[model samples]
Target chain A: MKVLSRLLQIREASILLFIFLFVGCIGIVNPAFTSGDSLGLILKSSMILLVLAVGQSFVLLTANIDVSVGSTMGLSAAVCGILLSHGVSGYLAVGAALVIGLCIGAANGLGVSFFRIPSIIMTLGTLGIVRGYMLFYTEGRWIEDIPHYFKELSAAAFLGIQLPVWIGGIAAVLAFIFLSRFSVGRYFYAVGDNEAGARLIGLPVRFITVLAFTFSGLSASIAACLFVMNIGFVPNQTGSGIELQVIAAAVLGGVSLSGGQGSLFGAALGAIFLEVINHSLVFLKVPAYWNNAISGFLLLLIVTGDSRFQLWLKGNGKKKKQEQEDMNRSKLPKSGEDGYEDKVVL
Target chain B: MKIKWFYRWEFFLLLLFIVEIAIFGWISPGFLHVNNLLFSMNDFMFISIAAIPMTLVIISGGIDVSIGSIMGLCSIILGVSWSHGVNVWLAVIIAIFCGLAAGLFNGLIILYSRVQPLVVTLGSMFLFSGLALVISGGSKASGYEGISGFPDAFVQLGNGSFLGVPNPVWFLFVMTAAFCTLLHFMKYGRSVYLVGINSKAALYSGLRIKWISLSTYILSGLGGGLSGILLTSYFSSARADLGSEAVLPVITAVVLGGTSIIGGRGSIAGTVLASIVIGFMQYGLQAIGLTSEQASIVIGAMLILSVMARQSSFQKVMQWFRQRKSNSSDLMY
Candidate 1:
């Protein structure tokens, strides 16, 4: 029971357990779903979302959002696909896509940090512009018959894991390290957790904030490359609506939209959970249409449950001190000797 | 200097609107006719409808992305129920109820959990649209094949006109008046502004913050419901994707109308006028042989430019006016 409570306390643990139970239930309904090979298929399919979520975690950690990511991926993949189809070398194609991502991400960062535009509107405008640019550049044409080498690279397996899976793993691992290791890494949480305090402490809050956006762009571009490689084609609607998926994954992994909480591993786990749910919909022979509703429902349940659990643990059941907490949250700390700073010492 | 006229939002927007009409008429001689203009005006009002309530929501320091999903869900409910032998009016009412429930759920969650409104609404955006799909019998019955065979009275509600004005345009006018009055003239209006400007202060001032917040969302839901029903009538069918394209335009209208995204300051009048401007601009661009997708690019540019204009300080403009005045005086000397 102690272990059970411990498992429940960590969002990642609970999400993992939930994923397995869901899969297991579907297996009961259809025995073939629990097979080892199908489980590998699930992991393989989740790789793109996992990579995107890892990137999104960096921005969410800084209390900002990048809604332009979906279009960024689309644009980058289009550019790369066009370039590769033109017989450009693979390295050059990759370099060009990364450059495009950097410029766009830098623009997003500057718009939010310098112009003081809200991140959502800034990125939303960018989302439209980037997608428009892609359409115009590609002339709304699909780039098919991508080079055979590129397709093979994406599909090639190592130690039973596909290339995209390995890339996603490296990304997750790298995100965890970058967020946990460097001193600047810790600044993201500080700035996001308490911006004014971080400023008062003489941190390069602007630099860190800009860096998060850049990292988000870089991650999305990487995902774009994987996308182009995996599917070996670039359609007009490529990467459409991916921002919501990446965001949902990050949120499911316990990353607070308010920022300063959650881990990349939890986000990766969330990607897996979402992907598995998608897979289970097939296994259960649920109408092909109910897939979206189920995931959306699960997204609500998890977030709502997590919040209620936090409130319950705080011993302030519904109604009691609710207004008091509101007042406290809105108010600034009275002086320098604040205890809230110590709470994030990890 | 006549620069003072520019400082009045209504005067500025009205002047701009007139100038815009003249310019469009100049560009396309066919644009000046009333029948042509009013015909297109029918499709434009629902955008105004959604933006009207959204103005109140933004003025209260929150947003409702889920309104789009609410519209979709309501449309689906009306369609599915009507196809199953229900009276169209009754089905519309049921659709409105679903909107209210969805909106109420959003308010309750945000109120109890104290989460950010954007994330909450974003989550529900997906949830409601997905539910709409399920109710429409999933992909098997979906993919642009909307439910049809509506009663003639309901069809007239979408198509018929009053005194040469489109019914949708009339609905827009009435809703705008009602909401503008509620937002600008009533005591509740003051509470909404007070809550948005400083929520903590509002709470301490004996205002019911919970109820006020909840009311904004409920009212926004009703706005979405009204638009959904109109959309069903307009097309004489209903689908799960109703109002999906309206999210960005609604947000754009609210912000471009001089509403601060951070909340506290907004005007219903500005939002209505801005929606008109945007709706016309979309039509105008398409009239010039630009595809709707290309026109979307232009609108996207307008959205960013409007927000950037609002974010910049008016001090610069004021300084320019002062400098011009001083230079004129020096020339007089």
Candidate 2:
């Protein structure tokens, strides 16, 4: 009974329902969309998105965002792919991608944690700097000719499931334990829920903040390696603007953008749902232009849903009170009432 | 830093702009021609126009990442409408209205839901851009080609000069003065600052916080619409992807111009100078032997550099955190 009730929880349940509804609607319109092959296709394509969203959940849990993830993914894929094509061993190529991820993640973490620039602005700036660096180094060309073995590895499956799927599944389970059962995991929620109080209680708030960002970067790099291994080529615009999609996926999965809430499972599921939507567009033969708008519309819808999820979790007695409280206390950063410089954290 | 010098970031930016120009002229003598400067100024009127209202939004402690996507949507509306034989001015009017509606939509959702501005606008950015692509007629022009064949008079809005100055520069000047008055001199502006500085205090002061917050977003949308109109006329075409690249520079101008990203403090004068500084720096870099790509990279480097200099603002952030902690236990929501 407990397991059944947990499975039926509103946030994840609603997302699950939407995925079915969307797929069913498309499946009815086009009989081919319901085929077993198409189902397999959606699952396989969602693997990369699932990977990236899992990565993003760590940072979001800490009450920060990483707009630079897309750039990090791009840089990782480019460097790894380029190295592979240049006759470097595949192991070294993967290692280089992880190193690139670590460096960018550390830089982003330092800027946000120590320098005190808002994560959004700092990451935005770094996005440009990293992209510009990539552009200058690559000189506006695509990185191609990745070894055939790399793509084959991604394609190979253990016991009928693809390799990437296994990777995502294993990562998801491990992340759930790490976030829910670990002290460091709880530290994220504590800091984001109340930053000053968290500091007063003697938490290494700075270290956790930076570590959260580094994890985000590290995830993007792993996703990058997956992407390069799967695609066999890294285009200049690879992962461009994908940060938005990744964030949307996490938010849809029930990860709160204001931070200190949600789960990696929800994030990974959200990524799956998004990829399913992206594939649905293709299956429905919808114009490519509508893709962005539809996903964006769904983002809004899901945000509304997430807030309702929050409300539902708050209990029935406080629903009205909480609703009223939300209206009164929404504008949080301005609490100083005097200092003109005070800003919103989340 | 004192409030007086904290208030002087824009002035410092202006000094930096002048220095950039002089350095460019020294590096390349041909860079100082009057015509080149005016024409260069024309390209950035859209940014300046957009940044004016963006200043107000940031001052109100909100950010509108969707504004660039709004510009794209409005331009497509103008392009598709004009192509289908709607009167040119009517198309523009319709586009601006649509843009205004989009902005209001952004405002409405954020106000009623109590969601953060960042999450709301980030979602809207994708939605608006997708809508632009949908309206652009996938079968006809596709996404990249956009829609052209606007009226000659409409085209002239972008290309024509007024009193020996380009239309965009004129647009920039007029819009700057208008925004300055609306944001700094008016009662509504004070309400905006009050709401941003402390909504609880604003409530006690008998201010309408929701309306002020909503209106700032609407103003931001209007600014985006105006820029869309200018960009369409200037490019003589409209693309779904138009203005996508300019989002960063617009935000850079607002923040680098001295507006606190946290809200409650900024000036139209600061945004204007920052706009000019960005335009000047881009052109100046190009003149002194930099590719457009290289200049863009430099601009990116400069964004990080400028933001890093504002380390003073974070101290107040800690105080704000304490206030939140004290209030959190008592506040049920």
Candidate 3:
């Protein structure tokens, strides 16, 4: 019963458990799916998504979203690629990417904070605008000729793990500490939980909101650097259709669409889970096109289950409240002592 | 009269429309030619036609991002039906029904499941796109090759002009007028506005908020279907990717026209004028040295700048400057 209660408490964790069990079942059916190289490749591929999800978790915690992260990554990578091709040092190229990403993020923050536009609409608009800028800047051409050192940073391994996996691990650790141990992190939850309450308490809501987006931007720049290093070429379709994947990862990780909940650890694990499932499908000889259908099916199942679980929780909360009310009623005296008892109860 | 003047975003749109024509006419010598002007209007007709119901949907406190995919799906269905030797008119009706069905799915999930409209529409956007790709087998359908013998009357709907103006433009004008009249003059229209402003309040007042939202989505679906049919006829080809790029442009037209994204306050007249403004801007910029891709930068900048100009921060800054100047003058005195 305790285990059941605990399972109910962490519904997303249970979902993750079910996913792993399913993956394990698949592995038992196809032993080849458990190979080291396959696992390594999946983790490496998930690194960018992991980074993106972490960044998005911050924004979502503040009741905002960064739908343009994918495009911003593409644009940043394109910037990096352009500079590196022109003989800029790798560090300098990365710095430039971060600065450009910061500018874009600042623009999104300003739009939402000052313009009073909803984050969803603002980000959606920038998704196109940023992608358009990237296209115009690169003239729809692929950026080839990335330096070998940068490529190694993306693909190379340490202690039998790829660099990106290690980077993702470090990022997750840092994010966990920052969110759990810091006052600023508590402020984010406060703001997302009840904006009017936070404002009444005198929290710097706008600055924190902007800071969340800046973190999102910085993370996207990092992901872009990792992405360009891995692919060695930046195409116009580099991050095409990635917004869905980022949102899916965050949602599957237990991030509430309405905001104020979720963890970076859950987001990373969700990214890993998604990437592994994708790899497993390929390993199991599923057709590439069927992947979308499968993911869509899984997404539907997960979201419906989550929503049902939420409904159950709400019902339980209501029942508990009603029970408490009944208990209070039963303890009350009949008519004559009502006034004295009411005063005592109050 | 004073109340009307104060509430005249639509009138402002008209003034901008006149200014656009004058500016474009002066910039490009050929802009004044009747044929060029007619052709430009024709080029913009499809987007404007599609923006009609979208305007209503936005004002009804919901959004439909899947219109582009619905348009593509409808076009594909129309082409497939035509290729199967069905009558063109019946095929068009079937295509419109397909669009309606897709939109119904969106409305049901959003209303019944209590999902956020943004998330639901985002999911449906991909769902419809995937469905289109799967049904079409990821290939373009050149039904013009097989249906080359379209009836002259059907062809004239796309190609022929009336009274020296293109038929497409006339269709757009009629549809816009009809929608404007419906949105402004009808009780249902007022209900839509009230619902958008406050759903709970509307419900308290005995309005069917869900039905209002659902019907607007259906209307958007129909609008998308009409745009698809027109586009398939105009380009004489149908593909799964036909209207994919129209999503951003249509939303931009709606938002740039000064319609509140949060819903309740907007004007179809504003949307019409905004479409014209965007159309002229695109054409005029293209007429200059800017490539189509570069023109996106300008459009993007304008969107950001317009929103920024509406910020309270700007107003605060202006007030601060005024206060500072006044204080300094008093000290000097």
Question: Which candidate's DockQ is highest?
Answer: 1
Q: Candidate 1's residue-wise lDDT over B1-333, tens digit each?
A: 566767756555676678878888999999989898887878777888989988888888888888888888899889988887888889989988988888888888777655567757777888888888888874335655799878899998989988998899999889989998899999999899987787767767778877998999998888888899999999998999989878877888887787777678889989988888888888887888876656667677676766665566554666677889899999999
TM-score per model (chain B): 0.92, 0.89, 0.87
Better candidate by DockQ, 1 or 2: 1
lDDT (Cα, tens digit) per residue for candidate 2, span B28-134: 88888999889889878899899999999999888899999999999988888887778999999998998899999999888655567877898899899989888
lDDT (Cα, tens digit) per residue for candidate 1, span A116-197: 7778778878887888778888988899968999989977989978888898898889889988998988999998888889
Local lDDT at A211 for model 1: 91
Model 2 chain B is weakest, by summed lDDT over 10 consecutive residues, at B1-10
Candidate 2 at B289: error in angstroms? 4.7
Fnat per candidate, as a fraction, reads 0.34, 0.49, 0.12
What C-alpha RMSD separates each model from the true structure?
Answer: 5.0, 6.9, 7.5
Error of 2 at A133 (Å): 0.4
Q: Model 3, which residues run further than 4 Å from truth?
A: A2-6, A9-11, A21-31, A273-286, A291-294, A316-346, B138-156, B311-333
Instruction: At residue A4, give the lDDT of candidate 3.
Output: 72
Give a tens-digit lDDT track for model 3, residues B1-333. Answer: 244353255665567677877887888777878788787776767788788889988887778877887888788788777777888889889998998887787777666555456555666666676566665663344321222455556667777798988989888889988998889999999998987777767766778777888888888888888887787777766666678778777888888776777688788877888888778777887887676656766676666665555445545755676688789999999
After superposition, the stretches of candidate 2 with alpha carbons farther than 4 Å from their true spots are A1-10, A306-316, A319-344, B1-7, B138-140, B288-291, B312-333
Please give, as one word, the docking class of candidate 3: incorrect
lDDT at position B37, candidate 1: 85
